[model samples]
Structures are given as C-alpha cells and as structure tokens.
Target: MCRSSQTRRACGRNDVVSTWDSLRLFSPAQYSSLPGRLMPSRPGELYPNAAHVVDYLADYEKRYDLPVQRGQRVDSVDRDGPVLRVGTDSGPWTARAVISATGTWTRPFLPAVPGRRDYRGRQLHTVQYRRPSEFAGQRVVVVGGGNSGAQIAADLAHARIDLIWVTQRPPRYLADDIDGRALFDAATARRRALDEGRTDAGGVASLGDIVAVPPVRAARDAGLLASRPMFARLNTTGVEWADGTRAEADTVIWCTGFRPALAHFAALRLRGTRGHIATVGTRAVDEPRLHLLGYGDWTGPASATLIGVGRPAREAARDIADFIRH
Candidate 1:
C-alpha cells in the first residue's frame, strides 16, 4: 500500500506517485510465498507452494509490466512534510505516496520466559525451521498452538521424534472440509465480537484451531495431536512444568508470534499503543500520508494470510492510485 500523500515537499525522483511505473515493491520471503497451503482445485490454478506462488507472481509481473526493483533494501521512511523520503541501501527514493506492504517475516516474536536465553538445548523459532528430518530421533518440544506449531509438531511426530506439544490449552482441529476463506469469515465475526466487547462469539472457531492440514490430519489419526499445558520455564536440560515435572528435550522449537517491523518508520513518530502505528482502515490516523498493510487484523482483517491480504492490498492500491490522481 502507498504510505505517502500527494502533497508537495521538494519531490524526489523515486516518488511513486509521480513515477508509479518506476518501481513497485519488495519483500524477502521468496516474494512472501507460503508453501504449506493446499493446491487449488481449478485446473491451471496454482497457489499451493512457494514455487507455485513464484510462478504466479512472475506471470503477474510479466503480464502487468510491474516495476519491481529487486535487491533494493528500504532502510527508513522519513516523513518530509507532504512527501516521504524513503531511504534505501542504494539511495533515497522520494515519493509523495509510499506504500508500506512490508510483511512480518523479518520480526519473529519469542516470548521472554525465564531461562529461554540460557537454555542448553538447540533453540530455534519456526522461522528457522523447515523439515522435521533435521530433528529425527530427538526429544522435541514444539511450543505455541497455531498452524505452524500444529504442523511442525505433527511433522516431528510423523518422523518418530519424541514429540511434546506445549500450549495454553488443547489445540482445536477444524473440520476436515474447512478452508481459509470460510475461516476468514469466522475471523471477521470474531473481530466484530471483539469490537462489540462481547467475549461469547459462539460458533466461530478460533483461527488458532488447527486447519487439519494433511500432516496434522495424519497426526490426529496417529493420536499424536495431544498437547500439554504451558510449561513454567526452560531448564538447563529441558522444560519444567508448573506442577514441577521436568522433561528432557534436545530441541525447543518456538512457534510464538511476531511484532510489526516498523523500525524503519521510526522517523514518522506515528507509532501508538502496543507499538503499533494507529490506522483508520489502512490510513495511519495520526499520519494520513502513511499507509500500512499486510501486518495483521490491526491493519486489515485477516491481512496476514494470502487470501486475506488481497482485499487490503487491492484497496490500498486503489487508494494510492486515487490519492495520486486527485
């Protein structure tokens, strides 16, 4: 999405509003590809793995003739009156309107539990994790209750690793027939309930519920999907439960969440409560020129997911185009 406004401020050459055709955008995750999703049902429809996504993106870019300057690192986005001075590793690119669609891959949040830093076992976040084969024949504790946590724990379980899942509560597995779009609708309902200050949003299962991905389904069938209560702390050798039981683990894979990597926007001084830049829709409430996208529900409902991001991205794109045209 465009983060800059059309107002003048000693315009620079890289300004997207003036030269939207000059450069488009950038991201680090193989163009932000998700490899875990199931393949599309329609023939010739592909959006399953990272490779398929790259293929689709390549075709889209080719078809649209998008101006994508790869390898250019955005260092900072400093507000200069009506425009934004986007500082990159190469140099400054100025824009009357800039879109900050920077996704959350860069910032992996690890909860600050006692002894987490001092743990003797191999510690890695799901970010560093790939296949379960690397952790074969070892006692592994997969933390968190989200999709990654569920899938990775399932992976370990399938690989015959001594698997233990630690979560706040038992993980919920969604119906086998459920898909992301349906879940996203449920998420919308949940959000509305949250806004209305009603905790009882009955029937909408938590997005945190395991989506019954193939590996997870297999784990369920194998009866390996059981989860333990959150442990008290990490130990020198393993983790200690609140009830004082200690279990040995060769690896501790954190599936914790992440925060928005908006340190680049530090110059804007627009950050509000919970270290998030407050926004009305995608527009930053305090800084109208700035727009944030693909962060999470705070930026847009279900904005983090592939299916969810398109709406916000399209809307923000339209808004940016409109802002420039006006």
Candidate 2:
C-alpha cells in the first residue's frame, strides 16, 4: 500500500486511532468539505478527533460509491510515450494525467542535531507518538515550535511524567479567539490578494503559531505549557543548553514536521533543488500532466489541511479535464 494509505489504515485501527492524544481538527467540521460533499455535522464539536475524520472519510467513500482499490502499492510513476505509466505491485496502468495526493504523513522529518547518535535514550518523531501514558514516569523533552509540538507537549503535561517542552525560539500562541476558522479565512484572503496583484497580507503565520485548542488552553492556563529554549547538544545523560544548563530526559520527541512523500515520482525526475516539484498552481511546471495536491502552500494556499485542500483539488480536477479535452 502507499504510505498515505498505510497511514489512513493505521489511524483507522483502534489501537492508534489518531496520530496523537488530544488530536483534534484545527478547523470546524463545517469547513471540512470535499468537492461535492460536506462533512457530516458533529453537534457541539468545533474541533473533532481524528477518529471522527476517519469515519467521515470512510463514509464518504462508501456513500459516493468511489472505486477505491485497497492495499495497492504504487512503486513508480513515469512517462510512457504520450501517457503516464503508473507501476504498482498489482499491475501497471496508463493514464493521460495523474493526480498525486499521497500526502506527507509517511515522511516524518527529524532534524539532525550534533551528538544525536550518541544520546542513550529513546528518540521519536511526532508520527510515532500515540498517548502520554506510554511515557509515564519518564522525563521527556518535546521539541519543535509548531502545533504538533505544542499539542504533544500539552498531552504529556498532565500525565505522570516530567515534561520539558523546548522550541527553537519562544513559542507563539494565537489569540484565544483564533482557531482554524480564522486561519482558513486568513489563508483565503492571502490567496485572493495575491491573485489580484495586491500587496501580500500574509497568511496563517501572521496570526501566530499554535492554536489554543482545549487541551492546550487548559495546559497553558495551569502553567504546564511553559516552553524553554532549544538545547545545544545531546549528551549520554541528556540535552545540554549553550549556557551549560542540562536536563536529564528518558526520551526526546521531535515534532519537526514532514516533507512531501514524492519518492514514487523519482522516475519522473521532476524534483528541483528544494526537493519539490515546481508547479504552476497544482500542475507540475516540468510535467503538465502531473498535478500534486495536499502537499502544502506551494500547491495552493493552506492545501495541506482538511478544510483547505478542496479548492486546490477542484482546480486540479478542472485543469485535468481541460488537459484531457485538448
């Protein structure tokens, strides 16, 4: 199976229902819509859990009668004459164009810090984190400054563990009233401004970094979400700050984020220096037949989120249809 499919299947399982504890949608359920269908309403849930999302997608698939082949692993995608050849474990299929929606979930990124290999403790990325109880009785250091880092730190704070959340810089919290809805609106405004050749008003980044979700808010209010500066290096016992401050930790969780999973497109050789395919909107600049979706802002503003991907997806479909017609 593809990496994204594997992620979805794993998430659907009871043991690992979501990527992490307190993992809820950043946006309201109303904004989580596909091209034609709206997400089924969940009463009183402005932010629903990951399992809710899994159920919604499963139901969407069945209700739409989508012909989705389960467990088919795609190995490569390359040009074959005038069409694109998709090599999968089951067989090869040719297509006039291809939409690569395999998201970055499989490609968890862990930054290389000095002495990382020498540290004698467990280290994992956010993708590997499930619940806080697993790290009970241990001194844990959570890294990164993004939402995942904040959420994971908050999840671990109330548990029976010694938690130290550290970021590269001071953590920035969005206003209490700001949520994914506001972030999405900002993104939309930014996109519109750029399209009209107006001065850029900035997107979600201008607001702040971490959204104060229920757990995060509670943690912050209780003074459990205080973050420290990033450590300089890892030693046998723990991490050391540049100022010689050291903290012993049994585990380090890196919430550094992810990269696009584009290994399947290696055969196309479309990746540029930044390790991303240059695109005009969703269509690859080098390979017009190739369209990427749900990667991130490069594909379209806020394209990586549940609520943000629909517009870009619709545009990509329209582009694909236009390509096929000509």
Candidate 3:
C-alpha cells in the first residue's frame, strides 16, 4: 500500500485486504451529500448522485456531529502553523492537516480539436448529463470506451435517433493490457463484424451480445446501433469521419472521461508516468505526506480499480494518522 520494496512484494498476491484505518480517503463525492433512495444498478453506473452524497454527508455530520460546511468551494490549501489553512469560496478555515479528495470527475478531459468551440450543436460532457429524457428524439454520438463512455453509449441507444458509438480504443477483458492503438483497431473491427452479423475473422468478442447498460447489445443483436471509429473533425453542421463520411446529430455527449486536476496542485512535485501522477503503490513520488488513489499504476496487474484503490487509501490514512497522532 505505501509502496516500498516490502509492500510491492506483498501486493503480488491478489487476495490481500488491508485494514481501512490506515488510509486517508479523500472522496470528492463527500463534498456533496446524496439522497438515500438513489442507487446505481450497474458496476459503473453513476450511483449515489451528488445530491445523494451530500445528503449522506449531512447524516454523517448529525451522527458524529462533524463540522462540515456546505456550498463552500475550496480555493487553496496550505500548511500554516499547527493546522492547514483552507481558503474556500466562502472564507477560510483551518485543519490539523487536509485530505484533498476533489475527484477527477470534476475535471472532464476534452480534446483540443480545432473547431470544437465553433460547433453549434449541444456539445456537453457526461458530468452535466442529468437524465436521458433531455436527449429524447435526438441523434447522439457518444465518444470513449472507459466505464463512463460505455455506460453513456449504452444509455442513449434507445432514443429513436441515430446513435453512433465512437472511441479511439476498444474495450478489452478486465485482465487485458489496454494498449491504446491496438485496442482501438480491435474495437473498430469488432464493431464492423458485429454489424454485419458475422463472427470476426480474428476471433474478437462482439458488443452486440452484451445484455446490460440499457440492453443496447440487443440492438447490435437486432442490428440497430453500429459501432464506428472516431470522427476526424467537427463542424457546426456535423461530424466528418476519417473516410470523409458526414453525419449530423442533435447532440454530442463527450463521455470521453476525465483527467486528474493536477493544475490546482502544480506545486507538488509529482512524478508521472503517462502524463498522470506516478505512484509507488499509493504513495506519491517522494512525498509521503501526499498520496494518490485512483491513478492507473499499471493497466492491469496493479490496476487502480475501486477495490485496488481501497488498500492504498487505508495504508495512506494509517500512515498519515500515525504521524499526526505522534
């Protein structure tokens, strides 16, 4: 969990479940409480919506009577005297230390395509997607292949509009290495094979058989939704594919995924692998006081799954708590 020679060796086993108290869990979801009734049905479903999270936090405060300020957006955090000074949108407060949990979702990753700002269609990120009804009767193109991408693509499949799923890479089995270019090509081939209702020549699995995520795989089974490669460019009127094909859509949901908001944390000398903060397990570069939870350490072996992240979180919290206790 704390990323040393010993911890790395121990992590080689898949069944290890570390104690929870050792980690500092900075769940950005805690910033907003949730209502009790909202639940996510699928693994990647956006459950415990922000409202639910906020409601839960309020209950937690009532139980433990913790002091939590709502509607306060934190501006800066710095060590000052015996406590850390956190400057928020409202005012400043102090803490013996801080756990920065502003999640990656707050920072949606958008591509810097040339004519993006000029597109007239309702271009929105998944973060803003409240419900599917907003997209009823609209042709929708969803981009990306990660959990969010897959879920959104599946959600918008039944709206009676032209639904095109585009991604630079394809989805692979949980254990696959997730190599980008190779995955994209593989996914593209799978889409075409599934559309034509034939087994892929290369033995790749078809998305058409999938039964979950709005059960749009039935469409693929029924030959409705056609998975395709990404568009080459975006114009106000429509999208231009690499093959020079054009399709107009009423809305484009960029479920492309998110990147860590390291810009706000630039002062920290973070070591990075793949443009993301690199970690030795959960520990940040050389800063033991800082740690990362959801970073993809390796694509598969030591992935950053929710289950994987828990171990590091517990370890970090324990280490930080001990230091503070002393």
Candidate 4:
C-alpha cells in the first residue's frame, strides 16, 4: 500500500546513519550491503543509512513472495481449540502455529523521574528522533547510554547544537578492532557452547555496546562523546542533578530503550515478568504452539538484532513447519 518513497523507516530516524553491528541472518544478501561489507570505510564510516535496511526488507518481501500483510495491527492472539486466532485491527486470522516477531520498536521506554511532566521543553523518545538539524542551535539533552543515545548525541553534537549526553553511568564505546563480524563470531561461539551443554562460555561481548559508526567516531574524535551522570529529576526548564546541579535544555531525547511488545500474546497467558515470554529455542515454554521470533536475547543470543535474528528465525521456522506437519 505504501508506494510512497517515504515509509516508516524513512521518516523514523532517517537522518541517523548506522552500521550493521552484527551479522543478521535470513537475508544474507541484504546483509552484504551493510557497512564495512560492501561499503567499507575506516572504522566503519562506510555504513548504510537506515533507509538501506528498510528498502532491502521491502525488496526481500517481494522477492520471497512472503505472505506478509502489512498494516494489520494485531489486537490479540487467542486460542480456539487446537488453532490460534490472531485478532487484528483489520480482521482475525487463524493459524495452526503463531510466530510472534513483534519487535520492540513500538514500545519506547522512558525512565520515571520526578516532575517528568513539568518539563516544558520539547520531549521525544528515540522512536521519534529523525534528524539533528531540527535541534540545531538548541540546547539538547540526550538520555541513555546505549547505541541510540550515543549515535543521536553524536548527531546533535555534529550539528553544533548545545549538547548534553546524559547516561545512568558512563557510556561504553566498542573498540575499533571489534567490527560487526567479530561480534557475530562471538555470538556463534556462545551458541555453540550452549549447544554443547557448557554453561561456562562466560560472557560474550554485549551487542548493546556502542559501535563506532562514522558519526559516533567523529564525535569521539572531536571529544564530544562524553556523557554526564543522569540527572535526578526534571524541572520546569531543564533537568536537576542529584547533587543539586541543574542544566537547561530546549529538548530532551530519551534513548532509554524498549521492552517487548508482547501484549498481543496476553490472551494466550504466556507472559512472564517484564512482558517477556519464556522460550526454549524460540518456542514458548508454556505454549508450544507459539514461537517468538525477535524479542531479543531471551529468545536467542543476538536474535533480536538484524543479523542475529536470522539464526533464531530459521530455527523457529523449521520448528513451526515440523510441528505443523506432526
């Protein structure tokens, strides 16, 4: 339906550039277009814009003839005897097995701070950030220490905006040596260890660590990537520090991350703490008829990511197909 050049990814943070931080499975060819893959640069500057991934996905849909009905916002997923009925905004569809790939994009998490409502400055979540030019010449405060916060803060600083990067603690920047490939190798190793019944695989490098993309790299090169400790609360004009210090801002961008969008599965009674459904290799522990595709590490290591999603998706597909056969 969206033949327009401006789709969701184009409008959503289109100005923000990103590097593929890991090897996303399913579409290996699409992954080929990722930064440093085809578009190589020093320290991963040759990355694709967010538009590349969006377009690739669209093309993949057409190429595979995937029966994906866009614009059908699922309202609920309930069980009807042996089949599952997915209630949507448009209508209801019944399936033998349901694979919920409902990613975290719709649910942006903002930390609760006292007087958060009192701040008069423009407020937005990472979901709403498009470009830095809008905040040019304005004092901006970016919250959270993860990749989005780092990249966005870098964008604002590059625009010469009065920028304040605030994290709960200091942000961690990934080393220059660690590219997306290396992260994938680590994830693969972790997966292998898990399969071998080894619990001592130790900690693989966290994908949540910030990749040094061009903007972020430039920000670091210019000494602009520094983040202050999070402020205690929001006030009328700005944020107040825990130590009684305060800073004024024209806008606040919350990159605090997201929780899973699993409310649709509420009717199935499969939710766990923090909106997570416990899964054993993508199969819902309580409901084997359901498979969660890309809700993050609980489903599989790096499975929530672009490259990492492929492995779990492939596995879940096989399991679902086999289950349906039996």
Top TM-score prediction, candidate number? 2
Q: Whose lDDT is higher: candidate 3's or candidate 4's? A: 4
Q: What lDDT, from 0 to 1, does candidate 2 have?
A: 0.84
Backbone clashes (count) for model 1: 10
TM-score result, candidate 3:
0.62
Cα lDDT tens digits, model 2, 77-145, are: 889999999888788888999888888877888888887999999999998899998997899999998
lDDT of each: 0.69, 0.84, 0.51, 0.71
Off by over 4 Å in 1: 1-47, 189-208
Error of 4 at 269 (Å): 1.3
Sorted by TM-score, highest first, which candidate order results? 2, 4, 1, 3
The 10-residue segment with the lowest total lDDT in model 4: 1-10
Give the per-residue lDDT of model 1 (tens digit) for 1-326: 22222121111223222111111111222323333332233353221444444445555555566676755667788887778889876778888877786656567789988888778999988777777778777899999987778877877777788889998788877777665656667767777777789984643454446677565777888898789999999989999988899999999999887677787888888888888998877888877667888788887777776566777777777887888888
Summed backbone clashes in each candidate are: 10, 0, 20, 4
Task: For model 3, state the Cα shift of residue 148 in Å.
Answer: 2.3
- Model 1 earns a TM-score of 0.81
Best lDDT among the predictions, by candidate number: 2
Off by over 4 Å in 2: 1-18
Clashing pairs in 4: 23-307, 24-306, 24-307, 25-307
- Number of the candidate with higher lDDT, 2 or 4: 2
Which candidate would rank higher by TM-score, 1 or 3? 1
lDDT of 4 by residue, 41-68 (tens): 2243245554545555555555556675
